[model samples]
Target: MLATIKNISVTYDGVGKSFSSGDFISGRITLELGKDCKIDYLSIKAKGKSEVRWTERHNNTTVIYHSKDKMFSIEQFIIREQKGQDCNVVAPGTHVYPFTIQIPQQAMPSSFKGAWGKILYTLEAKLSRSMRISSKARAEFPFVSKADLGSIPELMIPQHGTKVKKMKFFTSGKVGMDIHIERMGYYLGEDLNVVVSIENSSSREINKYTLYQKDSFFARGKRRVSTKDILKELGEPIPPSGKLKVTKVLKIHQHIVPSIFTCSNIKCEYRLKIVLDVPYARDPEIKLPLVILPATQTSGLQPPPYLTLGLTRRERKPTRMEQHTTISTAPGAYPPTAPGAYPPTAPGAYPPTAPGAYPPTAPGAFAPPPAYGMYPSLSDFGGKSEWEKR
Candidate 1:
């Protein structure tokens, strides 16, 4: 009689189940048998990949667009007998195999699942025996990648958009709106305070304002898009020749996935859209690219606590001059000659680092200029920062 397979399972070995690049994924595989069983081999495989597939129908014809990227795959043998030996026999009982694998240190997109595409990371174990189908168990885990906001100079730059529409058939005059944001990159849980100014010189009244986020997935030169409204406000009907200004604060949802642009087969992006409702005429709209970053990112580019957009002051990268020049502050150190002290440098050169440096500032007194892509001041948000409350 053949032994019966009781159970097969995989379990993680940590308080947190989520992992990131360069992090260890430690776990165990378990197997239980009812009686002594002859085992040929047992193995575990870990894989990360992205896939996108969709079909379009034309007149009596169908077109399919599909693509995939295998980010990584690893396999390890847990139970394998020597070539000269017969199949190994396993006594009836529960057995466990522990494992630890390190995720590759490279650019990888965060785990994502969409209607037309998905990026998945999973670990599976299998047991094979003579004259029996293999027993397999699989488990999925969440993975986050370092979205280096600091390196993307554009993320730190401020953005502005304006749209004006002149009414013709249903109304008269012109309606215009100007939208401004501090920066393009925002961490999860951060509030994006959008400042909007509206001028209604038209005969029709503006009734409402809607702000929403649009998510786009791109694969094989095709795109799938979805939209979710973040904030909706009723506008006190802006009479003709009226002007209004308002600030709307929208909190980035914690459950939303971070932006993914590293994967070529699949790309995920976000856009913030603002629209004004005008009766019987086209609405005025302003759209801006949005970059969503994880709050618990592992990238070494953590920004300072006070400022929302800039990099950390303590871990600030050294300037080019600081990196190439050396200074000896030891006791009785010989001061170099004037000509040699100040090395010929490129334009916009930082002050010399040698003895008698210009602007002889005190230690820790010279604060570096704030990096880009940070939140505005508290006053800009109308009071204490909402993020600081958390």
Candidate 2:
């Protein structure tokens, strides 16, 4: 008699298959058997990782470069041996095991696929039985990291670029362009406003204006790039020595991938390119960096078990892998605190030298600055303090 495994699969609990940091992933594993089966163990695993691989040719040799980083991995057993009897034997029928896990709210890169690298998130289940090949099933899902928009103030500030080209051989003057945008970062499906000021002092007729977007991916010291025209506005055909100013609007593609900088071995970036078309003359151009934010904001999630303490904020030590990757794997991890807690300073307290200055004494010293610059007020960024209310 043979124990036959019919099928195995995994499914999530909710309709929103996409996930981000701090999200709770609830799912189940389904197994179908044709007959009674004796199994050693059954388990499920969830993992996220980034990998890069490419080769370079030098002289007569080919040098291969590759790297990988494991963002997170969680594994648990659904069925295993019991202290008593009959735990390893699964009777014929459809069996389901439910599970729930929370993704570590850490600074990991978003899921991406590039020419030479990719960041992937997957769920896998396995069934093992004596004297039988293990049966396995796997599924992939999209993951967008909770972008910390407020981390960099410049992301919210306006950007400007200027370019000038002096007509030398065929043309006999100079053409200058000034471009301005409201900000460097924008959410998907948002309209990007652009202002173009052109000063044409050349002998040729200015034709039209072209604006486009380009995506670039870098991996293992090599780069792959693609460009797509977003919008093109017809110029008024400025005659020699003419000036025209126009405002152009371009919509960010809803399905485009956002900018990625957290991955060490790979990077994804975007650029806005502005061009001036002139007859029989070299066109002048301008480029600006663009950052695309996720369409949906991160939802409020419950803090992990370890962060339930009454303390408003606390730091956890980093593991060996974290030190090298520079990516925090543990949720709620923070900068180290002073040896002991300092007493709260009196209202309107200062060093007596400058108004509203930080305390100078040991007992009244201000809280240590955050690991990064001007961030994590404990209440401003992540909705609530890690454990302030609880």
Using TM-score as the measure, the top candidate is 2
Q: List per-prediction Cα lDDT, in the order shown.
A: 0.62, 0.60
Residues 1-390 of candidate 1 have per-residue lDDT tens digits of: 655888988876554556776665666667777877666666666678888888889998998888887777655454553333333565576665555555555667789987778899888877777688989999988888776568766678787898888888867788888989999888888988888888988774654545455545555566666666655666456667889887877778788888776665555556677777777877777777777888776432221111101111222332322222211112122122222232234221223342322221423322323222222231322233222232
- Residue pairs with colliding backbones in model 2 are none
Model 1 stretches astray by more than 4 angstroms: 1-4, 59-64, 130-132, 203-239, 298-390
Which one wins on lDDT? Answer: 1
TM-score of each: 0.69, 0.70
- Candidate 1 similarity to native, TM-score: 0.69
User: Which portions of model 2 show Cα errors greater than 4 Å?
Assistant: 1-3, 56-63, 83-85, 203-236, 298-390
lDDT of 2 by residue, 95-202 (tens): 665554556556666788867678998888877776878899987877886664577675787878998888877778889889899987788888888888888898
